[model samples]
Target: MQKKSLDAVLERLMTVFAVDSDSELARKLDVNRQTLGSWRSRQSIPYALCVNISEAEGVSLDWLLAGEGEMLRGGSISPTSKPAANPQEDAILALFRSLEETDRREIQSAAEEKKRIRDIEQRLEDLTEALAVARRPA
Candidate 1:
């Protein structure tokens, strides 16, 4: 597999966290400035750090790592004071937001179809157990 560019990932991290400098980015990542510099120099970032940033900042790992799909897991942009550099991304976000409620639901359902099927199966199992209890005499 091709390795991702750390500089690009770091740039996105700065934008997503609204940090103006590498020092600020390090602080946001909860690491020392020197360590952040080392990662930049090595062109690699730790997976644990990525997971931490994703969970803490509500960012999508896919977008942060590969610049694919929406930035946030819920497709909501971070509430940053600075505007994102990409206007096309902003426009796409606007179009997605303008979609009707049912349309949004359909999109979410399609995105999470596997999870929905697992949930349905769990419900079926619970109902089956309930029916079995109902059929038994006290």
Candidate 2:
């Protein structure tokens, strides 16, 4: 995997930390806002601060350095995050994730199919009960 440039790393860190600007990042890193502004504008940031950002955001150091590995340690996918590991599971998750975007629409459709068959059987019981009730003395 190609190593991500320092700027790219910082950008991801900023996004992961949910900070809108480098000044906010500097505040979190306990560094001067001017230093962070220079770093972001010039594509330079301290290694120590990088490490701090990774630790604070639960990112793997390796992934931060290179985009090859999972971004999050726990393999969670944020709105801007990418997939991490378990190739097989990832494929399965992709399928489920690709399902039509509705409230359990796939599951509900399958359940409705099953319910149709169940309703047929239930109607027989209902008919039998109705006949028994009709045949009984009033």
Candidate 3:
């Protein structure tokens, strides 16, 4: 199998996250350090992982995966420094940041639950199509 090229994307991630090494990047991405090394070795990053990172970090999916357009989505601020344009949004973000670790985990869990539901819905659609094809009068 050919190793996929991800040098540009990885470089951009390191720069954007202000990380010096892949281990640091892995920590920021909430992945095991070995997983980062494995990705580097395989030269492939999972699309779902990319999506999760994009959503969690407020980064643009296109920018994260293909390095196109701006690093962040419209109206989304970078976690490091950029402030939200709306004062209310800034205040909400500040409150979120001030939450305890357990509260933060709960919020993350809710987001993950939404992602799980979407995945399940897609899987159901796929299965329904397969079932229809299986029952076709051929």
Candidate 4:
């Protein structure tokens, strides 16, 4: 799957939490305000936190990461009960399940780096748009 922007993922998180500010998100996550600010400034999110939220709550990881599926899994499925994983997803899950703990940690680190870069790119894009708007005459 094509990687989604970190900013977009963050927006989805906000939608899930019904929050409009980072401070609120931080509070809901049980993290300090500075911690959240650090993550935003550094452009790196804690993958484990997202995973914990997904498992502890009923939220869907696919929707949080790639925005591919519904907001929730299991009981939140449609009336007919949509399948959780497609064939490709099934294959990936099988492989992922077989991996060593260290290997999984490596993959998680790589994902965090990718998300950091995506966040930076999104911030740059937003800044560029603001600049363009500022240059426009009244």
Candidate 5:
């Protein structure tokens, strides 16, 4: 199958979002900064990564990859609640929700590693508290 060219996708995304740098796009996509750099320089991105960014950012994949239509698939609609600082982030999250099992596993692995680090930090805090308690006057 013919893979979609990365430069085309990047250009469309840049135009749609009014962004100048891959870093900003990556931040919007919630992918590691380096990943965006790789996409920009190498002109390749994983399908999951593309989907991740597209969904999180609330971009239509058709527009993002092919430059076929409007930046917003549907026209502007008033948000009911305080909007996410980055509506695209909400799109990325929604994109993540639609991923396949294998793709989800990869994303989950990334998230789990971050969660594990947080858990370890919490445990360390608990230990520090216990040490403080032990040192308190009887």
Candidate 6:
């Protein structure tokens, strides 16, 4: 896999949203075209809006954020992969998905913060945990 820049993210989003141009994407996202250009210039997108699109459009957050998975929910990079195999995990995910966007975001933020603290305490990966691998050993 190659580097996933903001341009790639935006391009993937355009593909998902079926927009032919940035102007059309901006219109669909309800932002101004200049605002979209500014995002391209800064290489950043608002977290809340990304979350909104992921949940509302039934897309995968992993794909939206890191380009690590299929564009649709419950699918990752691996063709045979399943999002959740455990029944308890499936139930919890169902509950999480039922929450409002703001609540879901609060939960996600808190979970990330907790992971950060754990990483520091355990001397594991960095605070961002970007280097953390969640893969199951073969």
Q: CA lDDT, every prediction?
A: 0.77, 0.66, 0.74, 0.73, 0.67, 0.74
TM-score of each: 0.52, 0.44, 0.48, 0.50, 0.40, 0.51
lDDT, candidate 4, at 130: 99
- What lDDT is obtained when candidate 2 is compared to the true structure? 0.66
- By TM-score rank, best first, the candidates go 1, 6, 4, 3, 2, 5
**Who wins the lDDT comparison?**
1
Question: Model 2, stretches more than 4 Å misplaced?
Answer: 1-4, 40-43, 74-138
Residue pairs in collision within model 3:
none
RMSD of each: 14.4, 16.0, 12.6, 13.9, 12.7, 14.5
TM-score of 2: 0.44
What is residue 74's positional error in candidate 5, in angstroms? 3.6
Q: Check candidate 1 and list the clashing pairs.
A: none
Across 1-138, the per-residue lDDT of candidate 2 in tens digits comes to: 122486566656654554646687677667798876677566666677668767887887777765457766766557567545788988876775566423233444566779988999999999999999999998
Which is the better candidate, 2 or 3, if ranked by lDDT?
Answer: 3
lDDT of 3 by residue, 1-138 (tens): 134348666765665565657888889888899988888788887888778778877888888777677767774556877654798878887887687534644565576779999999999999999999999999
User: Which candidate's TM-score is highest?
Assistant: 1
Q: Candidate 1, residues 28-138: lDDT per residue as tens digits?
A: 878899998888677788978788888888889998888688868887546785575798978876887788534554555465777879999999999999999999999
Scored against the true structure, residue 25 in model 5 reaches a CA lDDT of 64
Q: What would the per-residue lDDT of candidate 6 be over residues 26-72, giving only the tens digit for each residue?
A: 99899999999888777788888989999999898888878675668
Candidate 5: where are CA atoms >4 Å away?
A: 1-4, 75-138
